[model samples]
Target chain A: MTALEYIRCIGESWPTTKERAYFEALALKEHGRLSPEHVPEVYHFDRTMSLIAMRYLEPPHIILRKGLIAGIEYPLLAQDMAEYMAKTLFFTSLLFRSTTEHKRDVAEFCGNVALIKHTGQVVFSDPYRVSQYNHWTSPYLDQDAEAVRKDNLLKLEVAELKSKFYERAQALIHADLHTGSVMVTPESTQVIDPEFAFYGPMGFDVGAFLGNLILAFFAQDGHADQVNDRKTYKEWILKTIEETWNLFHSKFIALWDEHRNGSGEAYLPEIYNNADVQLLLQKKYMTDLFHDALGFGAAKMIRRIVGVAHVEDLESITDVSKRATCERRALDLAKMLLKERRKFQGIAEIVAVIRQF
Target chain B: MTALEYIRCIGESWPTTKERAYFEALALKEHGRLSPEHVPEVYHFDRTMSLIAMRYLEPPHIILRKGLIAGIEYPLLAQDMAEYMAKTLFFTSLLFRSTTEHKRDVAEFCGNVALIKHTGQVVFSDPYRVSQYNHWTSPYLDQDAEAVRKDNLLKLEVAELKSKFYERAQALIHADLHTGSVMVTPESTQVIDPEFAFYGPMGFDVGAFLGNLILAFFAQDGHADQVNDRKTYKEWILKTIEETWNLFHSKFIALWDEHRNGSGEAYLPEIYNNADVQLLLQKKYMTDLFHDALGFGAAKMIRRIVGVAHVEDLESITDVSKRATCERRALDLAKMLLKERRKFQGIAEIVAVIRQF
Candidate 1:
């Protein structure tokens, strides 16, 4: 007999809870057509009870965030994540899918507006302004939080990204792609809990993963003890960030090239047939995407520092002052990335900036 | 009984024909929420028979194109069109409505894919490539047509615009808003025939109107006789183009200000409450929108000249060579506008270019 993992809403089941259940089930059910290896198989979904039963990872599969906190390295983490993001983002985009099929899904996924609005508030809005739900390391970061509200340039850039999140339906994205959403066992990686899935900018997903990894990297200072200085671990995280984006870019381009003659409606094969024009288009597309990923990734990093929901990486540091130091670094880097993201040409440049910090 | 105008599918009523009837009726039905004066009331719609009945404009309100071709100037044409475009586009956008409401309609309008695809082929695709449906003034425009296909920069710009049209669901736009789709007199303007309506880019409608007017301007020489040189009429057309865009810009801004505290989800009032920030955001928004309008208008003009659908303004010129000359001029202007639209800061600059042509 097969074992099934059931996710049930135990407490008061709000409309949003039920909605997420339905959407998550639909996402898993539809995963077979895309990259199915990293996604769990849906067995049964009971909408009324807000319950979902799916394949269980079992055994050594642990949440990626917990593993990061424990100083564990997954050698295949970057490659696996790159494969997952490239497949999910590229295949669902107009470059690989027909407009008709894409729009239908876009409309359907817009039902995840509950979570989208929540994200719009907590991630993009609340962190930048005074909100009842917002908090940090209290006095240690009080000035930093206030400075965020007063920064006009940061506000302007964030407004641009927020509007893009609301408007651009580039692909079906796994909306909440933080490390906590992934389960890994060195050789295996599984992305779970796609309750927030929707057709949004592909960079949102790419940025989420990269941004969380950066957060994990910053928190390593607080985690360091006598045994491990965490210097090598930090390098590994930066390397992973660089490799994931580089690999995703190449893989996405490869898919575009392979499917140039397919039903993808964005660039007709007849128009973009020549080598020079293809290179130009690819360069522009990837450049814009790279900038977007950096901007959104930075935004994600900022939210974790001061927003309502935060990661365990920084929270685990018993000393509040030390945790605040790590958070302040992440927050400063995020603000800079959000503002000066367009100035960055590649992931290596981003890595260099991180090293400087 | 009130006079009724019934639009019926003529022959071979395909699924697309029935789809158009349903969407057109929905467009007209929804027009009441935005601008009422410029739109005829929808009386009845039959999906099965592909028929629509609506209020009819009186005889004085001749089709705008016919009036333009005959050298008759409607003073209110620009004002009425500006009002129509601003109200319809603003009210239907996330700037004025919640994201949930907006996405529902966006999904519903995805059913208008048939016309959208047809538009993709004719306006954005077929004009720049070889298709059996493509035919210009032939011998006269053979080089011009060939030139369009050969111009790498023009093709690159068009592909960008095409992808935007396919992707950006900014607002509910009148997908076929050429002068022919409008009826007008010296005192009044009434927009009709929204069979191609969908939740697409607002600039598409604005561009379609301006592009057609530009076409009419280019065709005046062919229509010139001893009685009317059309020099003053030409100036009026250019003035109207300038007025329409400027008025739309101001009206759109006014609406945004009035509803700044409303339910618009795109720019939250709480975030953009300050005057400096508000001014900055509006500048960026309006600037991007202006460039989009210009690009889309240029594409519309080029398609009419070289694609499947030829405008009556250019077609009615009895002298074949004369008509060819007019088309060639319009084609040249459109190619320039498409390639260099970003360099233009104001509608007046665009008017200056139109005059130079």
Candidate 2:
């Protein structure tokens, strides 16, 4: 047993982990069923043992965040990710599935409550409150952390987001779909570690990716040295953020158009058959999703700065004062984005806002 | 057997009926756990037989709608109903319950999916689409019904609301809290027929009550005669509507304030401990809730007019043309409310709007 594979053993001690592995296996099975090209094959699953064995994407396939830190850009990353998101999200949602199927899947994923609770605490609650688990760069960023806790507007926005997180089961979300959750190479991008997967707002996954990329862009200043100014890498990160949302919008709409006659209970083909109404429906849907993505992304950013889990993008930056400055800038941007997300019209406006900070 | 008590019996052919009985029992139990006064006592529940035997509010406890139609004013109607709404909604919500308890109840009520589906259709879908189930006062208001179906803005607003109805499980709601569901007299108000209870937006319950009151107001003219004129009764209905919301607002806040230090996971006492932030949080929460209630109430009104079900208020108006006029005014008001609900500031503003229509 030289750790050739990860085995989530069934035991009295790790009931939460055991359940997560089971849910992850179930979610992956569902993902494969919906879109196999985007998912890893489950080699074996033992319900009694609470274990799953899956494929290994060997070397060159590194965590996307590490690749970003190394100033390596995946050419196909945006395109591949958008396809996976549109497919997995559309296929699993009430926009594509029957209510019967949707409710059954929702009920099953409700058992993934532990992972959801973890997210609820880390993303929504802990950051806004004085929590023992919460940490940031000490003294240098102490005031910034306190400001976050004291920002009534920010907490108000977060409270709405938190309620959405706990209550809204819009679709099956890869609840931890940050950059670190992705394994990438120059030509391939694979989503991994969906152990935190559950039925949640699709924007949560979208925000995690985009928000982490923004964090990556900010951290580039710290990662820069004499050898590389990292200016080009920073631009590349920004371009990826813009392109991901743009590509996702186009791809999601294409899927919706393709499935207009499908069994999506949200909009019946008979009712939404008119072109004008269809366009209006899609525009409203995408706009809401965009705002949700921005709001959730900002919350993710804020939490990484002030909540329990710190992201490697900023954490990898060594200088205490320098890292604090970077984190503070990101924090300010996140707070603004979270509060004013509804005012945003498109990714272009968002990119412009990102450039401002 | 002669009906001494309300015994919903089990039957092979009516499995849904059996399930509904069980759910009703569960909801009543939960409601009683929170507040015993407003809800009927569940004496016996036989899961195997799919039956529930509950307390009967005998004699003067006629349906509230009947009281309104007969021009009978319950002096304590506002106080009793508001208390019920505040207590039942607050206690069962994430505001009071832990996430574990909340999610568990939410899941249990999700088993009441059949009723949820009915609401999704009748309240959200049928009014916007040309469904065969849709009906109206025929010839006179055929155009009004057609306008409801054709109004793009109305449908767009409705779509968002529908999604919320399906996705947002903010609290354990009395899904059908219309006047027909209440048994009342001068001294008592008891909510009954919670067979459609489920975890949904609290506004659905609040909206149902207020919207029905609006319908009753509009129908007063049809019920008027030389003997009584019914103008005073209409004024009374308006007063009750106004007071119900005002009182409900105060009572709900009082509950929130009282439990500000409790286990409500929404706003942790540590973070929202500041009086300013707490006030801000409550204001935001209550404002959002008001908009939701208005939107949902408007939807309820619209469905009753042009969707599958017609309320006794409008249906009892013998003159077809007279009835159409009332229905059309209601339809217009509902459309405006659904589209411009966010513009409303408070119960006073809503009352003003109702007077204009």
Q: Give the CAPRI class of candidate 2.
A: medium
DockQ top scorer: 2
lDDT of 2 by residue, A94-148 (tens): 8888766777777778787887888898898898888899999999889999999
lDDT tens readout by residue for model 2, B3-98: 156765555675488778888888888876676777778889998777788786777679999989899989999998899999999998888878
Residue B60 alpha-carbon offset, candidate 2, angstroms? 2.3
CA lDDT scores, all candidates in order:
0.87, 0.86
What candidate 2 gets wrong by more than 4 Å, as runs, is: A1-15, B1-6, B10-15
Candidate 1 lDDT over residue span A272-313, tens digit each: 767887888888889989999999999999988888889999
Q: How accurate is candidate 2 locally (lDDT)?
A: 0.86
Note the B-chain TM-score for every model.
0.96, 0.96
Best by lDDT: 1
Error of 1 at A67 (Å): 1.3
Residue by residue across B88-198, what tens digits does model 1's lDDT show? 999999889987888788888888887888788788888877889889896998999988887778888888888778778889998899999999889888898887888
**Which stretches in model 1 have alpha-carbon errors above 4 Å?**
A1-12, B1-14
